[model samples]
Target: MLRRIVTFVIAVLILGALAWALWPRPLAVETVAIGKRDITVTVEEEGKARIREVYTVSSPIAGQTLRIDRHAGDAVAKGEAVVSIRPVAPGLLDARLRRAAEAAAASARAGVDLAAADVKQAEAQLTYLRTELSRAERLASQGTISESALDKARLAVDTGAANLDSTKASLSVRERELERAEAALIETAVSDSTCCTDLKSPVSGRILRVLAESEQVVQAGTPLLTIGNPADIEVAADILSHDVTEIRPGSAAVIGNWGGPPLAARVRRIEPSAITKTSALGIEEQRVPVILELASPPPQGLGDGFRVVVSITVWQGHDVLAVPVAALFRQGDAWSVYRNVNGVAKRQDVTLGRRNNDDAEVLSGLTEGDSVVLHPSDDIQDGTSIASTSGAQ
Candidate 1:
C-alpha cells in the first residue's frame, strides 16, 4: 500500500513540471518614458553656396584679347586691369580708295582754313564793336551826342558781339570735322605687333572663372571672366513645391555637413517660379528655390558653390510632451502607442500635434514619466505581458 501511494505522488509532480514548461511567457521589448522638452519640426535639404552678385567681364569692342595672367580665385581690386585687348588694324586700302581718302582729307583741311579766316574776321569785328561802344559811352557822358544815338551804338555793338560768338562756334565745329577726316585718311598699319588695351575690373572681388584665357580674337561683348565677392555669399536650396508653403522669409535655419560645425542662417526669399526636375528615383518633382542668408561669417574653406545641408525650422515649441516616433503607430484613423502598465502592454489612442524625423509632439492621451514600448511588434496587444529591454528613445 505505501509503494502505490509514493508512485502516484511522483507522477503528479512530473505533470506539474511539464505544465510549467509549456506555459506562455512575456515578450521582451524596448521601452522609454514620455518626457517634456523642446521639440522643433524641420525640413532638411541639400543646398549650395553662391555669391549674391556675379559679374561677367566682357570685351567692350571687337578686338584681340591678350593672354590672361590671373586665374580662377585670384583676388582683384576695383579698376585693376584684368585683360588687355588690342584693336585689329584696318585692312590696306586700294589705290582708288586711298586717293578718295586723300581727297576727303584735303577738303576737310580747306574747310578748317576757311573757318580760321572767318574766325579772324569775327575777331576784327568784335574789336571794332568794343571800340565803338567805348567811344559812344564817352560821348554820352560828355553830352556830345544824343541819348538815342548812344542807344543805337550800344545795340549795334551787342548785335556784332552775337555774330562773332556764332562764328567762333562754327569754327570749332569745322576744326573737329577736320580732325575726324584726318583720322580716316591715316590708315592703321597692320603688323605682327602687340598693342594692348587694358580692360579694368569693374568690382573688387575674386575671379570665379576665366572664359577666355589664351590669346584669341573675340567679338565685341564676348565674356572674358566672371568675378564676385566670396564674402557676400548666400545659400540656395531647392525644396519641393508642396513643402514650400510652410516656409516664409525670415524663417530660422541651420546649415551643416559642410566639413565643419553647423552655421546659423535665415530664409531671405522664396522664388516665385517653380522648376521641374528629374529626381534620382526618376520621378518628376516641382521644386522652388529658397535663398538663405548666413547669420554669421562662414567658417574657413567655405566658398562659392560649396555643398551644404540645410535644415529649416518650420515649427517649434518649448516644454512640450513628446515621445519617440517609434513608439507610435497608426491605429485605424487614430494614432496609438503601447504603454507599459504593470509589465503589461496597454494600447492607448494618442492625439499628435507636430512631429519631426525623430520625435513626435503628444497633444493628448500621454503624460510625462509614462513608460511606453518602442517599435512594438504584432505580438504586443492589449493586456499582453511584456518585459522592458534597453532601447533608444
Candidate 2:
C-alpha cells in the first residue's frame, strides 16, 4: 500500500506541473512610452465671420420717400444722395371741413377789413392832430393862447401818430391770418417746394440692405437702409462661459472651415456678461460672445455671417513630459495608471497637472522614458504580468 500511494502522488505532481505550464494567460497589452512633446491646449467651436461695424440710415424728416435707386451690394460714397424725400401732400378736406374753412376765411377777411377801417380813421385823426399842433405853436408864439395849452395840444398830436402806426401793424397781421385760412380751402397741396430733400450717406460703404424698397410715406427717424464695409470683418464666436474664462483679449487663435485656407487670428473682445442658451442636447448653458480679429486680411469670398471654426489657444507647453490620457483611470479620489516594469504591470497613483483630450501633464509618480499600458482591463492588477503589444513612443 505504501509503494502504490508514492507512485500515485508522483503522477499527480507531474499532471499538476503540466497543467500549470499549458494554461492560457493574458499578458499582451498595448502600451506607450512617455516622452517630451510640445502640446497646445485649445477650445475649439463653430463661429461666424461678420462685419465689424454696421451703419443704419434713417429718415431725417416726415415725408414721402422716393423709391430706392440702389440695390444691395452696391457701392456708395460719402455725401452721395442715397434717398430722396419729397414733401408729404396735404390731406383732402371733407365737405364739413370745407365749409368751416370758408367760414374762417370770411371771418379773417372781415377782421382785415375792420382793421383797415381803423387804420384809415387813425390816419385821418393824425392829420387833424398835426394841423392842430401847428396852430397851437403859432398861437403860443403870437401870445394868443397860454403856453400850457399849446403844450397839451402838441402831446395829443404825438399820441395820435403812435396810434396810426399801431393800427397799420394790426392790419398786416389780419391780412396774414386771411391768407392762412384761404389756403386750408384748397383740395390738395404740398409743402413749399416741388424739389426733394436728398438724404446722403454719412460714410462710404456698400449697401447691405434696403429697409424701404418702394416709394412710401415715412416718418422721421424711420430706418431706410443698412450699410457696412465688407473688407472690415471679424469673427464672432459664442463660447461657453466656463471656457471663455481662460480666453482673454489678445490671445492667439486660428479660423478654419471658411472654404479656404485657415487664417490666423487673435481675440479682440470678450463680452462683459453671459446669456442663457439652449444647447443641441437640450441642456441650458451660459454663453458669452467672443470677438476675434484677423491677423491678416480676410480671404476672398469670406464675408459677413459666413460660417467658420475657431480654435483659440488657451494653454501651451514646450518639452512637456506627458502620459497617454487613455492609460489613466480613477482610483477612489486619485488617478491611477499601470506602468510597465520589465514586462510586469505595477499600479501607481498619479498626481496630474494640466490635461487635454489626448495627453496629460505629468506632475508626479512618473519618469521620462517610462511605458504605461493603455486601456487597461479589469483583469489588470497591482502586479499583473504583461507584454508589449504594438505601440512605442
lDDT winner: 2
Candidate 1 per-residue lDDT, tens place, 1-393, comes to 999999999999999999999988999999998899899999899999989999999998888888999999999999999999988877777999888888988988898888889888988987898898899899999999999988888898888888888888988988898888778767676566767788988899999999999999988899999999989989999999988999999999999998888999999999999999999999999999999999997766789999999999999989999989989888999999999998999999999999998889999999999999999898888999999985755
- lDDT of model number 1: 0.91
How many backbone clashes can be found in candidate 1?
Answer: 0
Q: Compose the digit string of candidate 2's lDDT tens values, residues 1-393.
A: 999999999999999999999986758899988888877889999999998899999998889988998999999998899999997876799889989999999999999999999999999999999999999899889999998999899899989989999999999999999999998887777755676999888888899999998999999999999889888999999999999999989999999999999899999999999989899999999999999999998877898889999999999988988888899999999999998998899998988887788889988999998889999999899888888775756
Error of 1 at 294 (Å): 0.8
Model 1 lDDT-worst window of ten? 185-194
> Model 1 segments beyond 4 Å from truth?
1-13, 90-189, 192-194, 390-393
* Pairs that clash in candidate 1: none
Evaluate all candidate structures by whole-model CA lDDT and list the values in order: 0.91, 0.92
Residue 112 of model 2 has an lDDT of 100
Going through the candidates in the order shown, the clash numbers are: 0, 0
